[model samples]
Target: MTKIARRTEKLTEALRRAGVRITRQRAALLSVLAEAEDHPEAIELHRRAEAVVPGISLSTVYRSLTELENQGVILRHQFDGTPARFEHTETRHHDHMIDVDTGEVVEFASERIEALQAEIAEALGYEIVHHRFELYVRKKDGL
Candidate 1:
């Protein structure tokens, strides 16, 4: 199955396990987030969801997203001092580089950095469960 299909199935199962009834609004919300090419704030998600699901209340969007996040089907991050942004959790693990000026997030993975983190954690006799490393960088314009 495709990643999107797999995610949809996982999300449905998560909702069932959480005892949250899956409704049209909730399904639309999950679909928007699952197909998000970039991390999107709740408002942006609300807009897209509304486009696909008319009369879907903002509160419903918020509630549905909260449930999805709680179930670990989505990942939330806050950079640029803005409201939390959401991304599908089924994608490959990658660190983020945020452009401070433009408020863009670029995903990157560094094997060297990952190895160094493992070495440091081992030296400290701690096994890492999870870690968040965000790089805030600026691009030089050829002005």
Candidate 2:
């Protein structure tokens, strides 16, 4: 199965396990989130979801996001004081770098940074339960 199909299935199963009814509206929103390439705020998601199934309201999108997040099928991040963006959970861990000027997001990973985070947490006497990192950036002077 494709990535989209796999995510759709994950969301469906998670909802079922959580005892949340799988309505067509919820399923449609999950599918959109699953297939999305970049992190999209609620408005962007609502727009796309409406395109997929006409007449769906923004409120429905909000509720579905909240529920999916609670169910652990999605990850939501608020980067550099911007609106919250959502992504389907991925097995591999990564962090986001945001272009402040153009509002673009890029995913990146660094073992050195991960090790530093662990060291900091250990120094603080806290087992890193969970953490997320985001950096605001700008394009260079030239391409």
Q: In lDDT terms, which candidate is top?
A: 2
> What clash count does candidate 1 reach?
0
Taken over the whole model, the C-alpha lDDT of each candidate is 0.84, 0.85
All candidates: TM-score = 0.87, 0.88
Runs of candidate 1 with Cα error greater than 4 angstroms are none
Model 2: per-residue Cα lDDT over 1-143, one tens digit each: 98789988988887778777777777777788888989999999888877888777788788778878898878888887789998878757998899999999999999999999999989999788888898888989986
Steric clashes per prediction: 0, 0
